[model samples]
Target: MLEAVGLSARESAVYQALLTRPGADAARIAGDCGLAEAEVGAVLLRLVQDGLVVQSGRPTRYEATAPDVALGKLIGRQEQRLSAARLEMQRLTQMFRDAGAPGDAGQVEVVSGASAVSARVNRVYEAAHRQVRAFDRPPYMQRLGENLPLQQRRQREGVAFRTIYSRDALALPGRFQQDIELSCASGEQARVRPSLPTKLIMADESMAVVPMAMGEAFAETAYVIRSSALLAALSALFEHEWSRGVPLVAGPRRSSEQLDQPDEKTRALLGLLAGGLTDEAIARALGWSARTTQRRIAALHKELGVSTRFQAGAAARDRGWL
Candidate 1:
């Protein structure tokens, strides 16, 4: 609970022990927590500073603040500070968001430990007002996707999203593609990218998260980072890859051309090309001449200002056009 609420392990243990004992002195606290007498004294001092522990008597015995009172005080102080910081952030965020991005940012937040980092990652998305970008690679998708809603409620309010999946993700065959298909039909942008690292995000320039370590299997731990520079780099990266992603037919809302004129064939061909399929394959599947298909594909790319049909499709889908 200590770590979950953003407390250090030692800090939480000491605080909880304090609550149980009520008025344990330094020596007793040391014995209970298996810490040295001096260490106990130091921890108590920190607790006092945090308003969780109070010092009394000439020799300086320590007492735990009432749990409710102590927690309330801590929460209140944190809230005040957070409010102030958020206001300041809002001012700065306005400037940053308006500046068209001035390269990378100067600040970085490195959240360590795997479980805590993962939890924080979920927090970032939960707090996002814009779109959430997922750099999904393999089992991470299967596992993490379970925790994520298929379409975030904010998307209903106009939060645009773009997700990049690796080519190998197709190895999952129909099942995974079905999920991707489902995502597209809901309100998400999904495209295939090449080899990728574990990255998570919430909107453009809001937050950028990546694992601290990238092992072939799973890294024992990960870090969730939130910083301006990191977010900018990740944004550029997402855009670059998104520029190379394919298109899929979007939800009924993004692609509703009445009953008889569904635009299904064109959209399906776009999906295949966005997945990096060739014009020849697209033509074969669409039952059209390769020349005609290529001409239409080129026309689409030109209209979208994307060099490749894949980019055109990804961009189109992201904007709810395809």
Candidate 2:
């Protein structure tokens, strides 16, 4: 801890000893701190020079300076140095990025094989500081729950996550309740689209990982995109898709008497419906049977005074239930 403030271990020990025994000669400090008299004298001289120790009296006894004043100054200096280093690091990073040749391999790296892609994905997520944007679809390299803990930990650490799931992705067995809803509960801002053109994960506009193929070949090969025009375009595309996607809300199911005041269940139903999920997919997601799902949809439509699904969705949106 003291070293963090720029004190060596020997200096810290000597200073602590002096603090405990004010106006102690070098011999006394040496005995108390288990150092030789000569070593203690050298340390005391350095400490006095650094204003961490004061020497007085003809015998040259030493007293530790007030820790609050001394250590506070040291900490402040260390912080300044660290801030300067961070600025230099950022400058160097920008230079490195700019040094990449146009259409060079550095701009976009191709990683092949499922294991390599998985490693790259994890690395990208770990590097995310501010935000993570992802397009979730089928043909996953890892299992459904594999990335949940990582995502949750990042969210807890103030990293924002936005994911848009394809309908097919949510249609996976137990995916909706087990993975999607659980993620939403852990502070992930989730949305769903009927389909996605590709699978992508972008971290803080600095880097992105995109699968080269969909379906069976997904994740067999991936492109790791660094800071480039293509990355910016990809980010813009995500924004466009996100603007059109329907949000997924996770909350406890409750009963509501009025249609205008829909409960969590109704809101979820509306979201799934508006996201273009099939009746069977919605049933699977909500843990309802096909018949029950259809019945609820019909009731929702009647309550909203709409005959068709589209009209019901529009009415729900107007009522602020979606």
Candidate 3:
């Protein structure tokens, strides 16, 4: 047990003997452990440093501390030292790990290239199974890279990341700037940026990495980071950058106005639909043939990008264009 915590063989022997009989004088302790008195005293001093025993009395009598107290103290000291040692080791490990390729070591994998990188990012998006905590900087969001539009639409689907972006990414004009504005008008989260780049990806802070090489004509390299130390460092960097970002302007959206101010016929069609007008009833009421009414409803659905007329009505209602 003593050896387990790094005690010398002699130290273990002397310490064990002291425990078997706590009040044993140094001479008796030495004899009991088959050691010379001077040797016993030396080992006892070592044990003291090891927190296993202490010297008491003016004559320098050594007494063994209670096993519970001694063991607890020893283990606690060892654990503290081990924890500090591990932290230093982890820091060094991160340095080495970061220097190496971030290819999947078992379950973990690192991918590169804009398309491949977007695929990797989309894993987080599709898997959002919940919310998207977005921190989309303009340049990155607008990076006319491959598959940008599809990715942005998918990003806007959920509540989390859109707000972070709509509040921030919309301020700068470039790519998806209008989308950001549209989102902000929808009364979702969208903020403006004082400054930031087209880089950053983090989902639940469990994973986060930025492209070390961005906006280059060719190859894109992601500085994939996973270690808690590194992840924490990156998160801190994001938060610091986020703090400097501008707050989003809360105001009415122009899209709502555009959607509301349709032509009179479009408005009449929408109003009829809003009043629960079916195709047959709308056709009869508007004195239009059934085919024409269905065509108009179909066109309205196409225009609104809704699967159902109710959804169109709901969207119209949401935009206050009803």
Candidate 4:
């Protein structure tokens, strides 16, 4: 319990033993705390130097200082250190302002360690007011679950959240469907795509956290990008993928006419494409000339406002026409 105050487990045990028995010798503390006599001696020396235990009497007896007194001094020292750090931060901020280039462009930070990454994620979420766009998948920090309440609170406060999940992520060994449904119920727009380029979380289009390494196993190391052209490129990638994702939650209500009305032939064309059929095979199945089939396929692409067959299938699925 006192480890935060610079006490090791053995030191805490010896201190507690001394507190319980006012004038215990090293051997007595060792037996009581289940420590070796030599270890107890070393712990007692450290405690004495830390001012939590004092040496007294003939053979160097040990007694613990009152908890209130010892902890008060430790707290004072910590506050002094914090004050010094705050002053140093102010100095650095001013120096950067004087010497740094204008705007936040090209500013990037590589944050390592799981705890540090979690802290940065929380920091970004707290600073976001307008929108938070996220690409989420597996190999997540175990502590990521703790942020749900914060997300819900932000949703209540009118902050927009849009999340895209990989198809595999939703199929993991958990009650993910129920959890996702709950999230959607609370105003988060969600979508699913077969795969994603990377794990990303962008705040208000100004800042983003992306993996420094390629795969899920390297989730701990991340790059925090500030406003830069690179950030814009990341935003563009997200938008492109988002356009090709199937909505898991219902989007804004649209009139029936607003949804593209592709007829049965158009549906059949897309279904054949989605099934990996060749153009010739599709034409043979439909009993149409290859030229006519190609023209219809081109027309279908134009109707869906997508150039690629994959995007066409994704758009069809997103609009519930397939």
Candidate that would win on TM-score? 2
Model 4 Cα lDDT, one tens digit per residue, 169-254: 55443424235445665778777777788888887766788878766646678898877889889889988988987666321333
Each model's TM-score, in the order given?
0.46, 0.64, 0.35, 0.47
Model 4, residue 164: displacement in angstroms?
0.8
Cα-based lDDT for every prediction: 0.64, 0.85, 0.59, 0.74
Scanning candidate 4 in windows of ten residues, the lowest lDDT window is 94-103
Ranked candidates, highest lDDT first: 2, 4, 1, 3
- Give all candidate RMSDs, comma-separated: 13.9, 6.3, 17.6, 13.2
lDDT: which is higher, 1 or 4? 4
Q: Write the per-residue lDDT of candidate 2 for residues 289-316, one digit (tens) a residue.
A: 9999999999998899999889987888
RMSD of 2: 6.3
Candidate 4 local Cα displacement, residue 149, angstroms: 0.6
Best by lDDT: 2
Q: Could you arrange the candidates by TM-score from highest to lowest?
A: 2, 4, 1, 3
Of candidate 3, the 10-residue stretch with the lowest lDDT total is 166-175
Off by over 4 Å in 3: 1-110, 129-131, 138-159, 162-177, 185-188, 217-219, 250-322
lDDT at 51, model 3: 73
Pairs of colliding residues, candidate 4: none
Estimate the TM-score for candidate 1.
0.46
